[model samples]
Target: MDYLEYDDYTPGNETENINITTEVTFRGSKSSLSHVLVAFNIIILVVGLGGNSLVIWICGWKMKRTVTTTWYTSLAISDFLFCAFLPLEVFYMITSHWPFGLFLCKLTSSALFLNMYSNVFLLVLISADRCVMIYFPVWSHNHRTVRKALGGIALVWFLSALLTLPSLIFRQTTAHGLVTQCFTSYAGHSTHKAVVVTRFVCGFLIPFLVIVFCSSTLCVKLRRLTIKSSKPYKVMAALILSFFFCWVPYHSFVLLESDVKNHSLDLLQTGLKVGATLAAANSFVSPILYVFIGNDFKQVLKRSLTSRMEEAMAEDLRTIGLSRSKSKSVEMI
Candidate 1:
């Protein structure tokens, strides 16, 4: 669930001069923003976490025998985990204090960034899978094994973790009088700027570019298909739209932040703050828009959980209830 953002120690970053002159208000560093952000983020977090959790439970429980569902289930688990920690942001937004000390401050903030990276990485992987399957159908027919995709996804997670290592290296709690700010601690001022630049490129710019490229190409190719419409294409379209919806704001904010840095625009500070809060909300958007609403995600989720008990009586008839002796038995059966 942690989106994999770049590490904060990439070099040439303007960490020293990065401090705002009364731009960011906290309960000292982020206080006033917290009030609004806390309410919004907390609400989003509740919805996203709850929804994604259900998706994960269902996918893992009901579709455990399948491959794509397994990847999606893992994705849900990651995203939901991030949602679970959002209350911390909400709590800090209300009280404006990072009482958890340096360790937690760094870990929590870094975790959020990591989740961001993970989310994007997962999306990119999904897009790639779609493209590969379409372009090489015959090959995919032979090689598109659930086990193979799962292994690939596992590799994505590992690389995402590696890429986010910089966050853990740089995140820290900086207390200035009444406010305790959570931020990255690059080795040098230049390094901070480098970190930000790298983040803009690797996390936002590159991933966005890849998503757009892959999805667009896939869309064009799919459109040309003379074959009848299948359920998978619809799923592919939903996935792309979901990726676009959740991530646009976050990346846009990065660009806006770059532009707004030390500028004296009309509604400068307030605008930047508002934009940042919007960016944060991007973290929760996809879970609401995509995973919850797409295809039969809801039906699948319901079937995964309480459906078992309701249908337990009919267990003898058949697991799917469609026909007897269709699919083999599954799970704790």
Candidate 2:
């Protein structure tokens, strides 16, 4: 993406509004840091691909189509697709060139944002679903079907694709002497600001507030209720914390990138690159979180992988089911 340069420069003075330019100087020298970043991305790509593929297989086919599995399956599919497109990015980072042409460049970049938006949307849905199950168990037990869950997933995908259109539009390959560099070219400074702010608000801020609210409510309710399994709560906490740590740096650096003139361009670039790799690492880290928290190592070893995954996913459902029964019986008293 393009960086902004403010025209009004007064040392130690604050200006309310100022004119800005979309002038950017591209940096070329790949340091040892770039090598390290590339290595990390490659690891993420390999592990994320394998782990997300397993989740997709287990949640999509091995288990019965339920609301929880439907959500998990869609999440896995998003991450899997994100991982599938990482090779193009890894190649570009390694070579400092984009030979894949314009379409693939746009597609690959958009895929990352698509994953970001869709994953956050799914997390919000899962949290809200849990809240409804806990507070209004009877309503959820009767109404929360796989079909309805699929519909919500469809809406999330549609909105994610719509949000991703900007990346496709702004992303292009420009010949930089001997190299073709793929980058975003915003039409104006306001456009750049708009895109960055929108991503922060929509992709990060809103979902974060919703998830936090739902999770807090669920925790308080579950503590007082008759639910026995804490695995679901652990899984939810891990997922939220993982998403927070992984993406917060990326978004933070991205916001810092908006005021690129005040900060050292080289430092911002390096920070952004590192932050992005951390964000990509979330794809693999999620599956590991799910499996690791799902059950003990002994149980995982004793049971088939398929059964283990099924059991992990079903924990929330079983907990919710028991809560529903308990709530109903309490009414009879």
Candidate 3:
């Protein structure tokens, strides 16, 4: 994505009538901090991959493989895929330039965000599910089958796919002899701004609001109950807090990037620089959090390694217990 600059726009000021295509510089820092950020980022990427993948494996094996696990599994997959791309970001940070071609630059940005949105979307769905179970009780029990949950997950994937389509269509690499940059060329004159605005609204702002509202509502509702299982809220709270913390500054930095002057950009740039580090760090923490909250992870990585391990073990013992008891009854008769 290309940053837009404004000749007449002032920093920290919102202008409703400003041109959307105005070219702004990304103006981040070039200090020892960049080195430190990248250094830690490598460690984060490694941990995030191991942690999230563990989530998928555990959910797949040790859990009963219910609707919730399916949904969480799908979300984990998205995060895992995104984690796969972190090395690129780490490299770009250290190298201070995108050596990858135009297609990759755009795909990398758009795809990772696709996963990001997918993560938030699934979280919203989970919160909504909890709210239904809390408020509607019987309805949720009758209607909350795995089939229905899977359908919703499918829709989320389809929508996320549609949202990320712009990057594939518009993202391209360009070189001005000495300098190389990754950017998108909008088809129409005004369409670029229109698209950017659309992306901000649909891809980010709308979902963010939905997640915030749904998760907060769920948090409030669950907090009222003194149950052991509702403890998932703690996980939800930490996840949401981490999620927003990582992305807020990135979004703010992007907004500032689109409009701010050099001076303003410089300040926000430092924030942006650190924000990326924070975001990458966020990825790693999620997996570790899963291990703490989801017993499935711990159990699956046990001696048995099947997604159906929990069900199989329960069924096996149930069958053996029933068979022996039946023989005893027959002998007594």
Candidate 4:
């Protein structure tokens, strides 16, 4: 989010360049725009925390363990943890200061990136799982198990943690006049470029490729079959599309940041701020989208909160039982 540059000024005096840099950094503290961003983040914080928390409860505690449930549970856990830290971010944005200690700053930033990576990877796994189920139905029916899904989930977490290590290491808090900001401080231009490239490839590009491939293959396979239920395929498509839309801007800006000398620094900073906000918004939107699309919306709406949760749990258990029966039949055959 820190995109300001004092060195990139229009051919001007040193005094003018310094003034511009000061204006850009301090603008967030004084601008009404900061208030608007903080307000939006607050809304996301509330909704995302509630929605993801509910998903975690339903999938983790109530539902019988299954491959799908395990994935959903992991997704919910990531989103929930991200939302749990939104208050710190919101406070920082609103005050235009990092009152949180340096450790908390690094922890929150690392956690955010960790969640982002884990989410995209988990979605890829889910899409691949569905693709296998659709294209190799017999094989999937016999082989898909909660244990295997759990292993995949663990791997995703480990890789996510590894990927976020740089953020945790590089994030630093520094003060400018009365304002303090927390941002990644690379040792050199090469380090910054390397980090950006790595993030773009691992965090966005590769996962997106896998998602598109799986979704397209699944869609084609579903179309070939005479099944009347295409809603799941539609939901998968929407989820992938949403992830792409939300994250592409953020990654594009990050890449642009690496070569800020070639671009308008002011414009790039503005784009980065907007893109980062949209990307953060995705954490909340995802849970709401999944619940509305993946569940019986009308039924959920009619029941009390507790009752709805109970119903979801019961439904998940029934689904797991049916899946096990199908697996057994496939095995016998």
Candidate 5:
């Protein structure tokens, strides 16, 4: 989610110093585009906050804790925190300045990546969990406890935080004429390439592969077993598709950014701008998909939001013979 920004390069480097003016000019010209981005983010902030907060309330507080609720609540919390910080980004985008101190600059940058990593990791986990449940219902019914799910959630957050360190470390703010700009200051080109590549591999590539494998296998299993209740699979598939569509462009732009010499700078900057906004849109889009897609809107209106959410998160495993004891079937399989 990093922008095309002005770096706080080392002092007294004439060549690098001169580039600052050019960078500022390039950004200033994009002021109108920044306003568009700010508007989009403002909408995301409002919708994301309202949607994720309701999810957190329903899944975290109202519902009895289950493995599914635990995962949903964790995801909601991550999105909520990410949405909570959009005002900072909105302010920066509007003014084209970093009036906030260095701490907030680094914190806000790291927060965006933190949300990305955590969201992707959780999606992978959810897909994998469903794959296992469908394939081994009896075993999963016995073994898929909330405690283990919580442990997994903890591990995901830890790894996400670890991966976000680059943003925290490299982000810097410095005064450029009258405006203070916030940007990343990598040690060298090699370091920049390394960071971008690492982010792609860990944040996007690996999760993508895992999610694809799990969803594909889940589909195959559903077909082989001839199970009619595909509610869980539908939810998981939508999640996979949404994540894929939203994030692929951003990652593509990021990889292209590493080899800036070969790519058009305007293309890269515009791509990142659009892609980042799209990725941020996913935060709010998920609540709609997760909470509203499966339920009948009219019925949901009649019922409480809690009942609707619970129904949305509830798996129709009974139709697939998963809710019953199938030890003999498990043994035969």
Candidate 6:
């Protein structure tokens, strides 16, 4: 997905005084960069589409339903859908043209944002669920059910879509000479600033904070339990670190874009492109991370897809089954 800055261009006699020395150099560098980015996107599309689709099938169809499966299934769906749209983006990037027109421009952009917001929030939910299960096992046993998880997933999807409305509303395709570009446009400077601020806060900062708090609290609780195996903690740390590593650069570039002066425009643009690529890479990285988290390295190397999924859902099955037995005993009392 391309993140574009829509700046108004005005032609006047003052244009004659503007320096054009770096124009040719920037153009050459940008062309090479674009090719590299397009190739990277192609790789991401192939790997992400295949990996996430496997996760969806395993979680949704092959495995028994549970809260963990439900959450993961949703995550897989989002990543798969985002990767599905990458072909169109790859084509646009390769040709430097937007042949798909306005509706698709809006649709793809909205879908990207939808995946981003939904994935982060779902992670927060997962972290919170883990924390609750560990700290308040009794309450978790009584209340954490597949039905409740499904309901929460539905709500997260709705909120993600709602947050993506601005992208759908403002994204447009404009043709300048031979090149057609897809970008987000706002009616005024204030509107643009508001959109950027909203994205930074709602899309990045708040969810990140929630993940950190939940993870830190969960870490302390897990330490108190004197658990011998550090595997689960390591997996949690990887997930948290991956999320920030993938997103922070993109958001930082976005914020920096607004403040950059004219002389730094080329550098800022290149940075933004790199940031966007890193962010998009998250779709593929996440599924791989989940697989690693589910299985030991040797198991991952040896297991078939079905067995891998079964292994992934093993803990969920045990947890749910244990909760049911506990609840039944409490009811009998």
TM-score of each: 0.75, 0.82, 0.75, 0.82, 0.82, 0.80
User: Candidate 1 lDDT, tens digit per residue, 1-333?
Assistant: 111122222334434334321122223234555466556776778777777766666667655456567667767777776777677766665675666777766566665567667777777877788788889999988888988878887887787788777777776666769767665545653555566677667776788788888888987897888765455555655655655565566555544544443444434444544554554565566555444455566556556557677677578556557543444344326
Poorest stretch of ten by lDDT in candidate 6: 19-28
lDDT of 3 by residue, 125-192 (tens): 88778778877889988888988888999999888888888767776665656656554555653555
Residues 30-105 of candidate 6 have per-residue lDDT tens digits of 4778778777888999999998887777667666678877887788899888898888777766665777888988
lDDT of 4: 0.76
lDDT of 2: 0.78
Cα RMSD of all models vs. native, in order, equals 9.2, 14.1, 9.9, 11.8, 13.7, 12.6
- TM for candidate 6 is 0.80
Q: Name the regions of candidate 2 deviating beyond 4 angstroms.
A: 1-29, 296-333
lDDT of 5 at 116: 89
User: How does model 2 score by TM-score?
Assistant: 0.82
User: What value does the lDDT take at residue 215 in candidate 6?
Assistant: 87
Most lDDT-accurate candidate: 2
> After superposing candidate 1, which stretches have Cα over 4 Å from the reference?
1-16, 19-34, 175-180, 226-231, 255-262, 265-272, 290-293, 302-333
Candidate order (lDDT): 2, 5, 4, 6, 3, 1
Clashes of 4: 0
Per model, state how many residue pairs clash.
28, 0, 8, 0, 0, 0
- Candidate 1 vs candidate 4, lDDT winner: 4
Q: Give per-residue CA lDDT, model 5, range 1-333, as digits (tens).
A: 585442433444533432232222124335688668777889999999998887777667666688887987898899899898888877777677878898988888887789989999999899989988988899999899999999999999999999999999888888869888777777666777788899889999989998888888887777778765566567668877887898889889888866665666668778888889888888887777767553422233346666777776665655445635576677778
Query: Lowest summed-lDDT stretch of 10 residues in model 5?
Result: 17-26
